[model samples]
Target: MRGTVWVASDIHLGEAVPQTARAFYDFLGRARREAGTLILCGDLFDAWIGDDHALRRPPRWLATALDELRATAGALPLWLARGNRDFLMGRALADALGARLLEAPAVLDTDAGPILLAHGDEFCTDDLAYQRFRRIVHTPWIQRIFLALPLGARRAIAARARARSRQARRSKPMAIMDVNPAAVAQALRAAGCDTLIHGHTHRPAVHALELDGRAARRYVLPDWEFDHDAPPRGGWIEIDAAGIRLEQL
Candidate 1:
């Protein structure tokens, strides 16, 4: 953290999005060359049933992704955080790439300053249904049961849940899909940090706020979509002793 730290999130890599996979690999290469420490905030994969799938019988795409990740980790300090979609990403995946698993809402004392980092889904408190689903899936016993099932079974269940979630999202209001202001305030207070960085909503921006007569800032990371999107958006946050900046890819 003495040098420049790079952060990005929501790449959503999978077999279907080969373009995105390639773009991410290229980004990893750039990070390896440029960053002192690289942190993937979350959603690096579209769906990660378990690390066993990658370890036991990785498909060609997964194999390539892992290779790129391993190469990057070998060059620089790499950290992976779990997102809602890839919450199953665990020690197995981290160990494979020689990367450390980052706990959400991780506070970092960096060259720029102390900052709070997370996947950003937990702040969507306005989405009650999604919150409930998150709570259910996040329960240790529930996750244990799910992980105990065969990989095929787990994949099928995850697919169905994702489908249902997409369908439900279609009917939900846009406001409900975004983070709650009160939740943000509470998180800032709880973390005792003025600067926060996270990604999940896909709406990227920087915000200024006042908490307890102190200035605060929140940086929302952008999602990467290269296959279907017209422009193929992607970006990362760079932090140095000078300050934090959002850099487009």
Candidate 2:
């Protein structure tokens, strides 16, 4: 927390993203050597039915990803934050990886300064339908019921939900898919932080603005999609005494 910090998110690692997985493994290796603390902001996987399912029978790709994460955790401090897609990632998975679970919207005190960090989905208040679904799935009782079902049933449900989400996105306007300005301002003000870092929306950039007569910045982390993205895309944010620096691969 007092030295260099590296943050990345939305790798969406899955059976299909072999190239992205390799790239992420490479990033983990680099982070092991160069970063004092590493934070995986969210969506490390495309979907996470449950920790039990993963721990019991991880596929080849997941097993490799877990091994690299465990190695990275052994090398230095590693933290995981749950993303919208991987909201089921729990303490069991974190413990298995030798990493700690970080609650989203955590205020990280770094060498550069204190910054608000999150998976960046809650800020997308404009996506009302998705927000409603988020509320339902986030409900403890609902999650318990879902988790209690057989893994195959859970997988089927998740697949249907994902299909619905994709269809919804196709019909919605681009603006609604991104974060809302008011929501961002409120979060920064409530947290009393000038800098906010998060990943979602897949649009990575640094935005500067004035809030309550004070200058503030929001750093949007990039999503990794090396397999099919035309030019390939992935990146991370590095923070140190030199402040924030964005690195891409």
Candidate number with greatest lDDT? 2
Computed on alpha carbons, the lDDT of every model, listed in order, comes to: 0.92, 0.93
What global local distance difference test value does model 2 have?
0.93
lDDT of 1 by residue, 127-238 (tens): 9989998999899999889889998899899899889988998999999998888898899889888999999999889999888899999999999999999788899999
Q: Report the poorest 10 consecutive residues by lDDT, candidate 1.
A: 179-188
Cα TM-score per model: 0.98, 0.98
lDDT (tens digit, per residue) of candidate 2 on 1-249: 889999999999999999999999999999999999999999999999999987998889889999999999999999999999999999999999999999989998888888999898999998898899899999999999999999999999989988888898899999998999899999999998999999988999999978999999999999998898789999999999999988877
Which stretches of model 2 miss by more than 4 angstroms? none
Give the C-alpha lDDT of model 1. 0.92
